[model samples]
Target: MSEISREILSVGDLNRAIASSLEERFDAVWVSGEISNFKAYDSGHWYFSLKDEEGQIRCVMFRGRNGQVGFVPQSGDLVEVGASLGLYVPRGDIQLTIQTLRRAGMGGLYEAFLKLKARLAKEGLFDLERKREIPAHPRSIGIITSLQAAALKDVLSTLARRAPHIPIVIYPTLVQGPEAPSGIVAALKSAAKENAVDVILLVRGGGSIEDLWAFNDEQLAYAIAQSPIPIVSGVGHETDTTIADFVADLRAPTPTGAAELAAPRRDQMLQELAAIEQALSQRIHQRVEREAQTLDQFALRLSHALPNPERMREQIQHWQQRLKQAWLVRVDSWSRNQSHYAQQLEMLNPQRTLERGYAVVLNAKTGLQAVRNPDELNTHSAFEIRLADGVANVKFAELESRKS
Candidate 1:
C-alpha cells in the first residue's frame, strides 16, 4: 500500500478561508440582474437570487442595510445591487451581502420622463388649475385597462367593500405594447362620448418603466387632457410616477386608492350625517337659550321703566322733601361761612392792630416811610408816629450810633 500525504482541513476553517479571500478580492462590487426567489422574513431581512441570462447568485440584504432601498423589489424586476461577496459560514454557501439596491434601466426612462414632463408642462397640460376635481360621489365609474389585469380585482374589491351601490364600467383595452397608446385613446373617447360615468380611472399594477411606457404616450396625454369627464391616473406603485399622472384630474398611488377616490364609504357618510345633525341640534338649543335670556332681560327692563300712579306720587313727595332739606342745609352752610369770614376781616383791621399795642411810624418828609434800621434816623430829623386815631410829630434830641 502507498500512503498519500494530504492537507486535512475542517469545514469551518475552509469556509472562513474562502470568505476572507472573497472579501479581499471582491470588496465593493456591483452586480446587475433580474430578481428572483425573493422572500422577506419577519426579521426585516430580504433573501433573493440575482440572475442574468447566463447564471445566478444567491443574495441577502440584511435588515440594517435593506431599509435604504427606496422601492420594494418584485420578482422579475431588473435591479442592480452593490454588495460584497461572502460565504454563509453555517451552510458554506456562496452568496452576496447586498449594501445597496435600485431599479436597473431607470436612468434612461427617467430622462425620457423628465423630457416629456417638461414638454407637457410647457404646453400647460399639467396645469393644476385645469385639473378637474374628482366628484365626491360619482354615479358611475369607468375603468380603462386589460380585462385580465390583476388591478381590476383590487379595484372591484375595494369599491364593493366601500360603496357597493356605485356602478363599475370596465372598458377592455390593450394596456401594453405599441398598440396600447391607440387603444387607450379610443377608450378615453368612448368613455367621454358615452357620458354615462361621472369619472374615469386608468389603473394598472406596478411594472418596469418600459412596460409602463404606453401610458407615457404624447397623444394619450392630449386625449386625457381633452376629456370632459375627470380622470384619475393610478398606474404603477406609489413610487412610480408616469406622464399620465401629471395630465389626469387626480393621481392615486394604487388601483384600490383610485376606487376609494371614486366613491364615498356608506358608513363614513352616515357618521358625517349624524355629526351634522348633532351640531345643528346643539346650535338650535343654544339659540333658544340666548333668546330666553334676552326675553328675561327685556322683561326686567320693562318692569323698571313701567310707571305706577301711587309710586310716582311717592317719588314726587320724596323729592320735594329732599329738596327742602337740601335748601336748609345750604342756607346754614352759607351763614357759617359768612361768620367765619367776618371774624377774619375784623382781625385784619388796623384799629384792632393799634388796640393790640402795635404802632405805625412815618418820616415827616415821606409819609409812612419804611425804616428798616435805626440808622435811618439822625439828629434833628423830624418824624411822625401814628397812634390809633392820631398822628404826632417828634424830633430826636441826640444823634448816636450804637455800632458805628
Candidate 2:
C-alpha cells in the first residue's frame, strides 16, 4: 500500500478543516426544539442550547444584524432555530450558530415577545420611577391609536362630556401585528416632535394579549418611558396589564377612563365655582348686617346720651356763643394793638410833621437838606421845598437863612 501522505495542518488549516466538516456533514437548515440553558452576555451576545425530549444540541444566537430577534428568546421556550452546524476549533465540539429563531408551536413571535420584555425590563424601561406624571390640566391631549377603533369614539365622547374645550390631537397607528410596535413608536415620536400636546393618550380597545402585543414591545415601552411629555396608557380591559401600562405615567382601564383622568368635568367645576360664589355672598351679607347693627347701636347710644332734642340744640347754641365771644375778643385786641402802633408810627413820620405846617428845604444839585445858616446854603442854586401837598422846585437867587 502507498504510504498515506502525512497531512500537517496549521492552526488556521485545522479551524478551516473543522469548519468545512461542520458545513458539509450538517447542512444549514432549520430545527425546532425547546430552549435550554439560555445565557446572555454583557457584550450583547447570546448562547443557548436547544433540545428535544431525548437529545440536545448547543446553539448560539450572535449579536449580528438580527440581534433584535434575540431580545425575545428565553429558556424553556419552544423555538425553531435557523442555523449552520459548526465545530469549535479548540474543543472540536459541534454546535449550531443560530441565525434566527421562531416559536416552535406558536411561531417565533411569541418568543420575540418574551425576549423583548426581558430586555426592556433589564434596561429599567418599566421602572415606575422613570415614569412622568400626567398634567392635571393638559391643554391639548394627543391620542395614538387607530381612528376606527372603538376606543377612539369612547375617548371622544368622554372628553366632550368632561372637558369639551380641551383640544384633541389624533395620530393614527396600528395596534396589532408585527409592524404594530414600530408604528406605535413612530406615532409617539411624531407626537413628541410636534409637541402640540401636553399629555399623550396611548389607547386601544379591549383585546387579547396577542392583539395588544405591540404595546408590550420593548421599544414601545422604552419610547413611552423616554417621552418628554407624560403618557396615559389605556390599552385593553381593566384586567389587562401591558408593558406600556407599566411604563406609562398613568394607566387607565379604558380610553374613556383616560379621558376622564386627563381633564376635570366642566359641569363639576362650574358647580364648585357657583358654591364658592354663594359662600362669598353669604359672608359678605353677614358682614354687612353686622356692620349695620354696629352703626345702629352707635346712633342709639348717641341719642340716649342727649335724651331731649331741645337740650342738645341748647348745648350746641351755647358752644357757638362761646366760640363767637372768644373770636371777637381776639379780633378786638388785634385791632387795638394795630391802632396804637399806627399812631406811634405816625408820630415818627417827617411827612406827618410836614403836614402839621412844617416845610423841608433841600438843595437841588447837592440833594441835601437846607440848613438855617446862610453859610450852609448855596446861593444861585436850584432848591426843592417839600410841602405837605406838593413839592416846589425853585432857584435860590439869594441865601436867606434865619437863626432860630
Candidate 3:
C-alpha cells in the first residue's frame, strides 16, 4: 500500500465540519423522549435534554420559538419535538436545535384532526350555503353544555342581561371524556324533539387539544349538521376550533358571544320600534296635509263652476218686460179692425133701403107676383103694389105703350 495521505485539522475546524454535515444530512426531524435537566433562563430560552432508557439527546429551544410552546416543560415530561441535528462548535458536542414542541401524543391527535377535517370538508359539511341564519329575535333559547362547566354561567348571565324576556332551556350533558360526544348528541336530539327553543347554543370552556377532543367527534359533527333548529357553537377559546364549529349554523368566539348572537337586545329592539313609529306618524301626517290641500283646491274650483243666483234673477226680469210689450201691441190692433167691420155692415142693411119709400108691383091675379112688363096687363088687369109695410090692389085705367 502507498503511504496513507494525512490531513490535519484543528478542534474548532473539526467541530464546524461535523456540525455542517449533520445539518445537511438530517434536515428537521421529530423525536420523542422523556424530558430531563430542563432549564429556563430570564431570556425565556429553554435548555433541556431528552432521554429514554437506551439513549439521550441534548436539546435547546430558543426564546423566539419556546414562547409559543404554551406551557413550561418540567423534568421527566414526555415530549416530542421537531428539531435539526447539529454539533455545538464551542462545546464540540452533538445537540438538537428544537423548532417545535408538543406533548408526545399530540402529534397523532393533530394528524387525525386534519384527516377528519379534510374528509368532512370534502363532503360539504362546511359549505357556507348549508349554514342557517340565527334568528334575530328568538322566542326561546336552548343551551347544551355540561352543568359543571364554567361556560354555562357565562352564557346564562349574558343572555339574561341582553334578553331576559326570552325563555331559556338547559340540556345538561358531559362536555369531556369518552362519553361527551354521545351525551352532547342526546341533548341535541332532546332539544330538537321538544322544539321549544328557536335557537340552540353548544358551548364549552377553553382547554388543550386533548381536553377539547370530544368536540371533534364525527358523530357530534353529523348531529349538529342534521339539527332542524339553528345551532350556534361556542367551543373553547377564540383560537380553539373543532369539527362541531364547522358544522354548526354559526360559530361564536365565546359562550357569551353565542348568547349575544342568539337573542336580540331588548333595549336595541325598543329603539328600532320607536323609530318605526315615528316614521309612520310622519308619513300619516304628510298624507293628511296633502289631502287637505287637495280639498282646498277643489273648493276653489267649485266656487267658480257654480252659477250665480243673482245673475239668473236679472235675466228672468228682462225677458218678462219684452213679453208684456208684445202682448199690448197685438190687443190694440185687433180692437181697431173690429170697429171698421161694424161700420161697413150698417151701410149695407136692406131695411134702411126700404124705409127710403121704394115700392114693389105684383100681378093681381096671384097677388104675389110682381109685374115687370106692360103686356101682362091687357085691358083691366088687377096688380098689387107694396110699399115698405103695406100692399094694395089696383087696375090699370089707361094703357100707354110709350115707355121702353
Candidate 4:
C-alpha cells in the first residue's frame, strides 16, 4: 500500500470518500425491498429503512422527489427505489438518497394512473356533467378494436342477439402494446369523422397492466373526451379500470356489456309500443263514451234552452191574466172596503149625522168646538152648523144656563 493510503483518516472523511465511490459506481440503480420505520418530517422529507429478510439500508426521499409520488408509503410495503448511495456526513452512516420510489410491479402503473386521473379530473375531463348521454337506440354503432380481438366477437354476438336490426361498423386498431394507444386514437378520430354511427364503442379484452396500458394513455383519454361521437369504454374485466374508462361517455364492464348499453332489445321496444297502442285505444274509447254522454246532456240542455215564441207568448198571457185577476180581486176588495168605509163615514159625518137629527157645531173662525159649560163659554159665539146636505151658520150673544 502507498504511504498516503496508509495514513489514518477521520470517520467523516472516510464516509465521504466511500459515498463518492459508491455513487460513482452505481449512480442510479434499482433496489427492491420492504419498507420499515417510515418517518415523514415537517420539512416534507421522508426517512425510512429499506429492508429484506437478512439485509437493510437507510434511505431518504426529499420533498422535491417524493412530491411526485401519488400516494403515501406505509411500513412493510414492498417497493422498488431508484437512488444513489450516500453517507450522512454528521453521523458517518451509509444511506441512500432516493431519487424515485415506486411500489413494485403494478403499483408503479397505478400511481401514474392516479396522478393522471387527479390532473384530468381537476381539469374537468371526467366531469359527470360533461359526459355525453348514450343513445337509448342507436341506429348503428362504430367499434374501435382489433378485428381479431375476442372482445369484438363478444360484442357482435351480444348485439346480434339483442338488436339484430342495428348495424355495426368496425374501426379496427391495435388494443395492446406501445403503439396501441395512438392506433386506438386514430380509430376513434376516424369513426368521429365518418359521423355514420350514433355512438362509438371502444373496447378490448381484459389483460395485465402492461397489456392494457395503452388505454391509460393521456392523449387517448383526451381524444375520447373530445370526440364528436359518444364512446363507451369496455376495455377490461369488471375489476379493471383505466383512464379511458373515466374520460369516456360511459364505462361498461365488458365488451358485451357495452353492446347491451348501445342497443335496446327489439322485443322490449315492441312490447312498449303494444302497451302504448292499447293505452291509446282505451283512452280514445273512454273519451268517445264520455263525449257521447256529454253530447246527450248537451242535447237535453239545448232542447230545454231552445226558445219558443208561442209558448213564451202563452206564458206571458197566462201571467198577465193571473195578474189581471189578482188586480181585479184587489180592486173588488178595495171597492167593498171603500163601500163599507163610506157607510161608516156617512154615519159618522156631522152633516149625515145632522140628517139623522144630530148636528156638529164648530167655531166658525177656527172651525173648532166651543165649551158646552156656560161658565167656560164665550159671551159671543159664532159657529158653523154642519147638516146632512149643507152647512149652516149660527150666532149666540150669550150662553144659556139651565138648572138641574
Candidate 5:
C-alpha cells in the first residue's frame, strides 16, 4: 500500500539543525574534566579537549572571556567549566563554548569567599567613609610580608627606585599556610603599637585561591580595618581579590604597586615643587607689576595737580617786561615836565624882561626904594632910573601933578 513520503536533509541543513537543537535543548552546564591538547593562539583564544575516563569533548574559550580565569590552564590540569553545549556547523562536531573555568575542587573555596565578602560588606568594613586617606608624602613606610617571599623583594626594589629618601620598615611574617592569618595580625598589631609609620603595605605574590586563602581570613580583614596607619593591600595579581583588599584603605594590583602607592616618587615631587615655585613667582611678579602701574598713575595725576615751573617762569618774565615799560614811561614823563618847568621859569626871569627893553626906577637918597608917583618925590629932590645896562639920576623941575 504504499511508499511513504520521506524528508531528506542536506549536509549543511543537518549540521545547522543539530547545532540549533543542542543550543536550544541545553542551558549553561558545569562539567568536570582534565584538560588535554590545550593550545593557546596568538589571537588569545584557547582550544582544548576535556576528558574523563570514558568520554571527551572539545572546548573553546575566547580572549574576551578567558582573561577572567586569573590563571593560565595547562594540559592535564583538572578543571571545571561552565559552558553551553553547541555543534560546530562547519565540522558537524559537538563542542563546548566555555564561559568560566576554575580548578576543579575550588568550588567550595570560591563559595566561602563570596559568603565572607558579602558578610563583611554588610558589616560596613568596606565602607568608604571609614577608610583613611593615604598620605601623599609618608614619613616612613612599613611592609608586612614574609622575608623569604618574592613579593617582598619586588616591593623593596620598587620603593628604592621611586623614593630612596623614605625609610622602610619590614615586618616579616608568614604569608601562607594555616598560621599565616595570625602572623599577619600580630605584625599589624606590632606596627600599630609602634606608631612609627605613616602607611603600611600588605603584599603577596600571585597564586591560586588555595595559596592566597590566608589573605581572605576574617581576622586579617579586621586587622586591616582597625589599623592605626593606613594600609595598602597588594595580594596576588591584578585579577585576584581578597578580603584584605576590600578592608584596606587602598588596594594595589601587585606588590610593586603597593610600594608605589605608599611612597611618592622623588622625581615627580620635585617636578611638582618646581611648578609651584614658578606659579608663586608669577603671582608675585603680577602683584608687583600692578603696584608699579598704580604708582605710575598716581605720579601722572600729581603732575597734573601741580603747576608747571616753565609756565610760571614765563608769566614772571611777562610781568617783568610790563614793569620795565611802565618805569620807562614814568621817567620820560618826568623829563618832559622838567623841561616845561624850566621854560616857564626862564620866561618869568627879570633878566629876560630887562633883555626885552624894560627899566627899573628907585629913590636916589634911598637907592633901595623905587619912586612910583610924583607926589612922593620932593620938588627939588633927585631921583634915579635903572635900566638893563645902566642907572641915571634926575631932579624935579616943576611942581605940577597929573590927576588920574
Candidate 6:
C-alpha cells in the first residue's frame, strides 16, 4: 500500500452528509406513477412503491408530513408523488420519502372517481341530511347480492335467527367477476321495481381490495345513493370500507350484522308485546273495578231510597184532582169570553145584515156602485142588485138624476 488517506466519519456525520446532499440536489422532485405496495402503519407512517409500466421506486410517507395531504394513497392507484431522495441510514438504501401524493393519469377511472366523489359531496349527496333512517320493524326485507355467495348465507342465517317471521325477497345477482357491477345494478333496479320491501340489504363477504372492487364502482355507488328504498351496506369485514358504505343509508360491519340491524329482534318484540298486554290488562282491570264500585254505589243508593208505591199513588191522585179543578175553571172563563165575542161579531156581520132583508146594488160595466145621477151612468152598461143569497143583473134602461 502506498499512502493511505484516513478520514474519520461517524454514522451521524455520514447520514448528515448524505441527507444534506440529497436536500440540496433532489429536495423537490415530482415523480408520476401508479401507487403500489401501499401500507399505512399504525404509527401514522406510510410505506409504498410508485411504479410505472416498466419500473418502480420504493417510497415512504411519514405521518407528520403526509397527514397534511388531501387524498389518501392506495395500492394500484396512479398518483403524482412529491418527495426527497434520501438514504435510509441503517440500510444505506436510497428511497423516495413522499411529502405529497396526488392521483396520476389526469383522464382515468381514478380521476373520475375523485371528480364524482367531489361533485356528489358538493351536492350534499354524502350529507347526513340526505341519509334515511333504517326501519325498526321491516315487514319485508329485500336482499341484493350474489345468489351463491357466503355473504348471502350469512345474511339469511342471521335473518332467520333474528327475525324469522319477516318476509324476505332475495334479488340475487353476481357480486364479483367482470359482470358483477352490471349485475348488481340490475338487481337493485329489479328490487326497486317490486316495491314490496321496507328496507334493502346490499351485502357481500369480506375480501381483498380487488375482490371488493365491484362495490367501489362509480355506477354502483350512484345506484345505491339513488335507491328508492333505504339500503344497508355490509360489503366487507369491519376493517374494509368502500364507496357503497358511504352512499348507503346505513353501513354494517358484516353480513350478519346487516341482517341484525335491518330488523328488530323477535324476543325483544315479544317482550314489548308482553309488556303492552300486561299494561292493557292492568288498565282494564282497574277500569272494571272502578265501574263495579260505581255500580255498587248506585245499587246501595237505589236500595236506600226505594219509593213507597201506595204513597206515590196517593200523590198522583192528588195532582189529578188539582189538574181537573184547574181545567174546569179555564173552561168556564173560555166559555164566557166566547159568548161575549160572539155577540160583538153578530153585530158587525155583513151577511147577517143582508139576511135581515138589506140589499146592495152595483153597476156591471165599470163594476162600480149604481148611481142615481144621469151623467154618472152609461146606457150601454149593466148593473147588479144583491140581496141576502141572490143577485140580479140589470141594464140601465133610463138615466135618473138626483140633485144633492
- Pairs of residues at least 3 apart in sequence or in different chains that clash in candidate 4: 351-387, 351-388
Model 2 lDDT, full chain set: 0.76
lDDT of 6 by residue, 139-158 (tens): 78998887768988888888
Candidate 2 at residue 229, lDDT? 83
RMSD of each: 42.8, 38.2, 55.6, 44.1, 54.1, 37.2
> lDDT of candidate 5?
0.84
Worst 10 residues of 3 by lDDT: 345-354
The alpha-carbon lDDT assigned to residue 226 of candidate 6 equals 82
lDDT, residue 57, candidate 4: 95
Clashing pairs in 3: 362-370
TM-score of every prediction relative to native: 0.55, 0.45, 0.56, 0.52, 0.55, 0.49
Cα lDDT tens digits, model 2, 1-404, are: 23435766788678879789779988888989877677778877788888887899888777773465734565666777788998777766678887778776533545576677688778887777777877776778888988668988888889877886566778788888999899999998999899989999899988645677778777777788889989888898898678888788999998789888988776776577567656755665576568556655655665678769677666655755675566567656755765676576446545677789998777645423344446656667777887989999887676666666
Candidate 1: residue pairs that collide: none
lDDT of 5 by residue, 1-404 (tens): 23433767889999999999889999899999888888899999999999888999999999999999998886666799999999998898899999999987434567689899999999999999999999998888989998788998899889879986676777879999999999999999999998878999999999867789999999889989989899999999999899999999999999999998888887887677567656755665576568556655655665566588566556555755675566567656755765676576456445576678986556655422445566777767777866777778877777777857
lDDT values for all models: 0.81, 0.76, 0.82, 0.80, 0.84, 0.77
lDDT (10s digit) by residue, model 4, range 324-402: 5665676567557656755763454234545777655656443243334445445466777666677787777766777
Q: Which has the higher TM-score value, candidate number 1 or candidate number 6? A: 1
Q: Pull out the clashing pairs in model 5.
A: none
- lDDT-wise, the better of 1 and 4 is 1
Off by over 4 Å in 4: 1-106, 307-404
After the best TM-score superposition of candidate 1, give how far the Cα of residue 362 lies from its true spot, in angstroms: 99
